[model samples]
Target: MAGVRQFDEDSAFEQALEVFRAKGYRATSMLDLAKSTGVQRGSLYNAYGDKEEIFSRVFERYADRFVADARVALNKAGLREALVEFFVFAIRSITQGSPARGCLSTKIAVEIASESPRQQELVKKMLDELEDVLVGVLQSPEARAQLVIPPRQAARIIVTMTRGIAVMERVYSDPKRLRQTASALIDTMVRPG
Candidate 1:
């Protein structure tokens, strides 16, 4: 009981995630994480190690949830419907709040990918997981019949375009524009049959 933490670890991680999403890895400090999380700085360090360790754990959780959500979105009755749902899910992630937080993975990839190999691998693994999910959906009989390109290629394109949408969401902050772009990409890559 002496070593048990009084605070909720998951709640603190969520709070810290919000701060990291808003400020990014380079700009966020341990003090900021502690303040946002409403936990003492010493407690935070003791509970989650340093900022990098905290980030790695938080990022893993985020990526896992994101992929699970993608799987759900791609489970529609039809390929077109599933792809639409998937894009909608992706769009919501980037445009959830005022000023738009964008994709944390995308932010990490662009901001700190070169500086930290561990962080870079995390981003890469997340993207790979997403692509694998897409490929699974695309390779289904319904999806394969509707797809103009191979499942692997189409999956990669969808993943790449989703990253582009993340950037565009920040620039335009217009969900409609992003949806329209996704629809167009779907139209081009997937047959209407």
Candidate 2:
């Protein structure tokens, strides 16, 4: 029989994800993955095919987890509360997390080339899905008519604001300021004056 594999797929993926989260997609080298996953380069290649494949898997996992959390928050008592929770979670994640940086998808979005049509499409799809979820929560037909902006566009604005807040938190560590900004954003979206 061949030698037993020391690292399982899930464990390997988690370690690889940590590296990706810390260094991002373009900066993370195969050697970094090998070191992070505690596997030889040959074994990593055998298991994951390549760095791109591994990055794709990690991205899927991250996106899925984020969407899942957002869904749970959406189901909570009130729309405003859910929005606050979402922004609070995002700010805390970006400001005080282990890596202490902005989102992986956002980081990749900056680096992805226009020539890479597939990556660009994937990013757009991801953002669209996020907007769809937010719109589903903000289901106000009256407001839609009054504003003359589709729910999709409104949802995009909310998501964009949350992402911007996360980026700001990465630069500024004042929790009170972040919380105030999140509160103001939710207030504006919900009670729009």
Q: Quick one: best lDDT, which candidate?
A: 1
lDDT per residue as tens, model 1, 48-109: 77999999999999999999999999999888899999999999988888777889999999
Q: Which stretches of candidate 2 lie over 4 Å from their true place?
A: 1-6, 113-115, 140-150
Q: How does each model score on lDDT?
A: 0.93, 0.73
Candidate 2 local distance difference test against the native: 0.73
Instruction: Judge candidate 1 against the unseen true structure and give its global Cα lDDT, from 0 to 1.
Output: 0.93
Residue-wise C-alpha lDDT for candidate 2, range 1-193, written one tens digit per residue:
3455667878888888778778877889999999988899998787778888888777777777777777776665566666778777766666656557567767777776364676666667677778788887777654444333556776888788766776676677666787898788666666553
Worst 10 residues of 1 by lDDT: 93-102
lDDT of 2 at 60: 75
Screening candidate 1 with a backbone cut-off below 3 angstroms (N, C-alpha, C), the clashing residue pairs are none
